[model samples]
Every structure is written in structure tokens, then in C-alpha cells.
Target: MNEQKIFDNIKHALGEAPRNQFTTEMHLQMIKYADNLKSITAKEFCEGVGLKPSFGTEFSKMRNLTQRLKAAGLNTNQL
Candidate 1:
């Protein structure tokens, strides 16, 4: 399925949560698609994940920084 379609399905399945809970649920769902996501840029990943631009930017920053931290052998638990 296409990006929009995938997220639409995710929304249907996990749409009942409050705003913050909804976002967390969405991220958990995205974990299933990690291998597929690795090939995409942040913008593409956000689009695929069906997040609004602002939220997508935050997600992108979180993802990029987390990856950077991991590569630097830093523990994310300190965050």
C-alpha cells in the first residue's frame, strides 16, 4: 500500500487515543515498518507515516538525533 493508505489504516486501528497517546500508538505501529522506513528520508518518512508537517519535523529531529546518539555510543536513556 502507499504511504497515505498505510497511515490511514493505522489511524483506523489506533485512532481512539488522546493526542499524545495517539502519537505514541502511531510510533509503535511504525516500528513494524522499520526496515521499509530505513530507505527513506525524513520528509518521505513523515509523509509515509501520515503526520502533519510540524509533528513530522519533530519526529524527524527525534529520529535523526536518536540515530546520531546511538552511533556515538551514547545511551538514549540519559535523555
Candidate 2:
């Protein structure tokens, strides 16, 4: 999917909710987007997802998720 579409979906799923309310699916969507993006910064991802770049830990986790998903050939255990 295009970056805009991915960002819109991520925003629909994860944005406007408190971080604690984010579901695993929502996070996975974000991680998948992170992986799909060839070169993106935390600031750029946050902007695209309508989030604050202050969420550094979350971004870090997303990067880790990207690696894990890639290592596993993008196969994921759906929740």
C-alpha cells in the first residue's frame, strides 16, 4: 500500500486513543507500516500517524517489531 494509505489506516486504528488503549492489532499495523517504509524517521512516522514524536519508546518498539517481522519473513501471529 502507499504511504498515505498506510498512514491513514494507522491513524484510524491507533490515533485519537490513549496509548494504553492501543490494541495489539493497532500496534502491529504500525509496525508493519514501519517495515514497509524504506527510510523513515521517528518524527516522520509520528507525523504520518498523527502522533507526537515524544513517544520514543513506542517508536523504538516499532523498529524492533520491524526487525522481528522481517526476520520471520513477515509472518505474524494474528491476534
Estimate, for each residue in 59-78, the C-alpha lDDT of model 2 and write its tens digit.
76777877777798775434
Please write out the lDDT profile of model 1 over residues 1-79, one tens digit for every residue.
5666656765665667677687676555554443335566667766655567566555555555556556788553442
Off by over 4 Å in 2: 15-20, 23-26, 72-79
Best by TM-score: 2
> Model 1, 61: alpha-carbon shift in Å?
6.6
**Model 2 scores what on Cα lDDT?**
0.70
Candidate 1 wrong stretches, greater than 4 Å: 1-5, 18-20, 57-79
Residue pairs that clash (backbone atoms under 3 angstroms), model 2:
none
The local distance difference test score of each candidate is 0.58, 0.70
Give the TM-scores of the predictions, in the order they appear: 0.47, 0.66
